[model samples]
Target chain A: MTWQPELDELRAREAEARKLGGADKIARQHAGGRLTVRERIEGVVDPGSFHEVGAIAGQAEYAPDGTLKRLTPSNCVMGRAQVDGRPVVVVGDDFTVRGGSADATIREKPIMAERMAHDLRLPIIRIIEGSGGGGSVKTIETTGRANLPGGVGGTQLYHYTGANLSVVPVVGLGLGSVAGLGAARLAASHYSVMTKETSAMFVAGPPVVKRLGEDLTKQELGGWEIQTKAGAVDHAVESEAEAFDCARRFLSYLPASVHALPPVTTPTDDPARREEKLFTHIPRDRRRVYQMRPIINAVVDQGSFFEMGRMFGRSIITGLARLNGKPVALMASDPFFYGGSWTADACAKIIRFVDLAETFHLPVVYLQDCPGFMVGLAAEKAATIRLGVRAMAAVNQTTVPWCTMIIRNAFGVAGVVHQPANRYSPRYAWLSARWGSLPLEGGIEAAYAADMAEAEDPAAKLAEIEERLNRLRSPFRTAEAFWVEEIIDPRDTRRLLCEFADLAWPLLTPAPSGLRMRP
Target chain B: MAESPITIRAEIGASVWKILATPGAAVGEEEPILILESMKMEIPVVAPHDGVVVEILVAEGQQVEEGQAVATFRR
Candidate 1:
C-alpha cells in the first residue's frame, strides 16, 4: 500500500507546528521587541541544524468526522543542534504559547529536554522565557482544580540540574520575563545570559505581586541590574542578539561534555606572542595601583577572555580564556577595585569560577595580587574571612593543573589561596611578586607600637621601623630562601601559560570518565 | 529645574594618584573621579550619577581620608 496520503498528513501537521502560536501571538511577541521561540532557537544554534524531537506534542482538536481541525504545539522545542559545529541539545521555550507557562505544555516536555542532554552526555542550552514552562494561574480554571507543587517533574528536574552540572555544560538564556521554574532553570546553568530590555527573571510577575499591594515594574523588580548584581545571573547584554552571541561564545570554549577535554583550535596567534604593555601596565612603584585588564588581555590569546560575574565582584576578574587556542579558566586581581582584595563577594566569585574549571576539566591560570581578606570592622561583619576560607576550599578541590603568577601583593591567607594547596602546583611563577604575613605598611605599626610610642621622635622611629621591615619583605629575599619558584619577565606570561595548557591537556585525557562537572 | 552639584567622596583613606576626569568632563554613575593609592592599593572615587565635573577638590599627590571630597559633579 502507498503511504503518500499519510505522508501528506504528516507534512500538514509539521507546518501547523512550525506556525508556533499563530499570527496574532507572533505579532504581540514582536510588538514587545521579542523574538519568537523558533526565531530564538534559529538565532542561537547553527542555521538549519535543529532536528526537533517532538514537533507535534501539544493541544489538538478534531472535526465530527475525525478530520484534523487545529493543533497548538508545545512550548518546549528541543532537539540536537550544532553550536559552532559542536553538537548540543537546544531547548527553546515558545513564549507566544501561553508565555511558556505550565498550562501550555506538559511537564514532560522541558524535563525531557533536560534529560535528553543528561542521558546523551551532551551540552544543553535552555532558551528560557516566562517562568521556564512553569506555573500559570489559568491552570486552576482549566483543570477544575488547584494542585500543589512537588508532585510533577521535581525529582527529574533536580537530577538533570545536578547531572548536567557534573557531566555537561548547561547554558541558560533569558530572552523574556522568567519566573519560578524559569528563573530556576536560568540560575542552574554553568553560564547564564539575559537580555537587558526584554528579559527579567523573578519569582512572580507584577500582577501576581499586586495581591500584596506592592507596586513595582518588572525591570525594577528583577531586571539585569538587580539579578546580575545578586549573582543570580552571570551576564546581561543590551539585546537578545547579544545574549545569543554570548551563549554561542560560552559553549565554544567548552567540550561537548565532561567526558572529554575542551576543544582546542589550531593556534593562529603565536604561542610565544608577548605584549610589551604588560610592563607598562604593571607600575614599578610599590605604592601605586595599575590597571590589570590590559595585562590579562596581553597574556591570553588575543580577545579570548569571556568575563563572568563582572558586576558582582569587581575586585577579582574571572573568565574563560584560550591560551594558544587551548581553553583555560583565567583569574586575575583587578587592582582598580578593592586593590584586588578578596571581599566576601569576590571570594564567592572565586568559589564559582574554580568550580567551573574543575567540573569542565579546564586548567586554571591565576594572576594573583591580593593583599588579604579586606581589613576592617565592616569586613569582619560581612564574614569575609569565612567566605574567604570557603574560597580556599574550592581552590583546594581543583584537581586540574593550576599555574599561579604572583603579579604583586600575595600577602596573608588569601594570597596562599591562589594555587591548590593539596599538590605542588605545576608552575608557580612570580613577576615582581611581593608576599608577607601582612603588608609592611600596616604590620610594622602594630609590632612596634610600644617602641614608636617610647621613641624620642615618633615619626623618625616609624620611618626607621618601616625601612627595616621593607628590606626584609622583598620578593628577592623570599626567592633566595626558595620560598618562590621563578621570577619571570611580564612579557613571558603568554608563553608560560601556553606551556601550562600544553602540559594540562594530556593529563586530562587519560583520566576516568562519568564524573559530574561540579558546578 | 537647576542641577545641583554632588561631591564625590573618598570611601577609603588614600593619596590621589591621578585625576581621571578633568573639570567639565561628563561622567556616568560608577565612573571614577580619580584613582587613589592607599595601603599600596588603587581605589577609585566613583560618581553617583550622570553629571559634569564642576570641580576637582582633591589634587594629585594630596592625601584624602574617608569621607573627604574628591570632586564636585553638577547633576
Candidate 2:
C-alpha cells in the first residue's frame, strides 16, 4: 500500500528491461566503452538532481508463444535537472534500444520535454547520441508501412526548437554517433560540443558513405576536431565532463530565456583601478612590433579575458574581458598579424563576436590598430569587402557601449569603421594614432611617382617628398585639426581606457533582446 | 643511426611574436617555427625539427630572427 512499493516495482522493471535480448547484448554495449543513457545523464548533470518523466515506458516485444516477452520503455531519457543550481531540462538518446531509430522513439517523450522547456522557459540541453530518430529498415516491417517523406513529428520538433532558439538558449552535447535529425538538433543550439573519443555527427555514417564510394572513419566523417575548428560546433572537449563545463560557462553569460536580461555579477576590481603599463605598450618605432596581449591584460580587470575563436581570427583578437568587474567584449587589432589588416576570416570572426556581445548586453571595447582591409587580388577573391562590410554593420547595429582606442595604425575604411557614430561612440581615445589612407611605405612611391619621374635626380626627389609627407602624417597634425580626440602617451592608455570604461558603464542599459543572427 | 641536429633560425629581424613550441615538444617539419614580428608583420619560424624541439634559446618579445640561433633539436 506504500508509495515505496511502487518505486521498488518500477526499479525492478527497469533492471529487467536492461536484461532484454539476454546478457550477450548487454556485453556488446559494455565492450563499446559507452555508458547507458542513465549513466550519461548522471555524468553530465549535477549529482542526484535528475528527476525522470518517463521511466517505465518502452518498446513492446513478443515471444514465440505470442505472449509479451518484455516491456521496454522508449529508448530516450527525459528529465529536469539543476546544473550549477540552475534548472535545466535534459534529454538523452539510449543507443541500446534499437540504436534509437525513429520506429522505437516514443512520440510522447520528446514532445513532453520540448513543451516543458517552452512552458517553464528553462534551457533545454539535448544529449544527442545515435542517429536521432531516423527510420530504420525494421520500422517498415514492424509497422507494415513506410514513413512519409516529410513526417509531422520531425517537422514539429524542428519548428519548435527553432522558435525556442530565439526565445531560450538551447545547448546540444553530441556524445555519440549522431546523424540526420540529430545533427540538425546539434546545429540548432546556441552552443554545442562534441566528445573527442566517441562522438561524431554527420548526415550519414561510414557504411552509407562507403556505398557512395568514399571511405572514411567515424572520426574523420564527423569528428569533434573537424566540426569545432570549422565553427560547426562551438567547442570540442576531451571528455563529457569538459563539455558539461563549457555549457555551464556559456549559460553563465546568458539568461534562461530572451524575455529576461542576463544576470550581472559584481566586479572584483575597482572601476578606477588603472595600470601604468598601457602608456608604453605600443612601441614608438612604427617598424617594431609589440605584444598586444599585455596591453589588453593591463586595460581589463586582472584575469578576466575569456577568448573565443582564438585560432580562427589571427589578425583580430576577440574575447570577453571585464572592466571594473563588468563584462565587456574586447576586440583589438593584432598589428603583428598582417599589420592588423582585416582579412576575410578576421572580418567574419568580428561579425559573430560583436553579434554575441550585442545579444548578451556586453559593451564592446575596441583597441584599434587597424591598418586597412587586406588588399590585392587574393583578398578580393575571398570576399573581403562583403565580410568587412558585415563586420562594420554588426558593430554599428549594436546599441551597447562602443568605446574605441586608436593605439596605432588607423587607416582606410577598416580603421574608420572602428568607431561608432561620433555622438554614440563609446568615449574615444587616441594614443599616437596613425590615421590616413595607408602607411607611408606603400604610398610613398605612388605619391611621388610624378615628382620622381620629372626630377633629374629621381632618388633625391623621392626622398624629399617622403620626408615632407612623414612630417605631415604625424598624429599631432590630426589632433591639432581635431580629427581625433586627445593624443595621449602610450603609458597613459590604461588610465584613459579605465576612465572610458567608467564613463561607458552608466550608459550600459540591459536589453531583453534574444540571440542575434550569427554571420 | 642517430638523426642530425635541426637548427632553428629566424626569417626576419624583429621582436618575437610568440613561441608555439617548447623544448621536447614534437614538431613537424612544416609546423610554425617561431612567430616573428617586424614592422607589425608576423613571420612564422618554420620547424627545422622533424623531431622534438630540444631547446628554446629566445624568449617572447626578444628581438631575433634572420639567421639568429633560436633553437636546436635532434631530428
Which candidate leads the pack in DockQ? Answer: 1
Candidate 1: which pairs clash? A131-A182, A132-A182, A166-A516, A166-A517
TM-score of each: 0.90, 0.79
Which TM-score values does chain B get in all models? 0.89, 0.84
lDDT of 1 by residue, A1-519 (tens): 899999999989989998899999999999999999889889999999999989988888999999889989988888889988888999988988888887887778777888889778789999999875336777788888876665654567766866678777899999889998888889889999998998899988888897899899999889998998788899999988888899999988988777788888887788998788776666677666777888888888888889987887777999999998899999999876668889888888898888888887899999988888877766799899999998998888778889988888888999888899988775555566778888877687888889988999988998998888877877777778888778888888889889989988887762424334444
Score each candidate by Cα lDDT.
Answer: 0.83, 0.73
What is the fraction of true interface contacts found in candidate 1? 0.48
| Quality class of the docking in candidate 1, CAPRI style | acceptable
What's the distance in Å from true for residue A250, model 1?
Answer: 1.1
**Model 2 alpha-carbon miss at residue A363, Å:** 2.0
Q: Which stretches of candidate 1 lie over 4 Å from their true place?
A: A152-154, A210-213, A428-431, A510-519, B1-32, B36-40, B45-52, B55-75
| Best by the TM-score measure | 1
Candidate DockQ scores, in order: 0.37, 0.19
DockQ of 1: 0.37
* Model 1, residue A16: C-alpha shift (Å): 1.5
What is the fnat of candidate 2?
A: 0.22
Kept native contacts, as fractions per model, are 0.48, 0.22
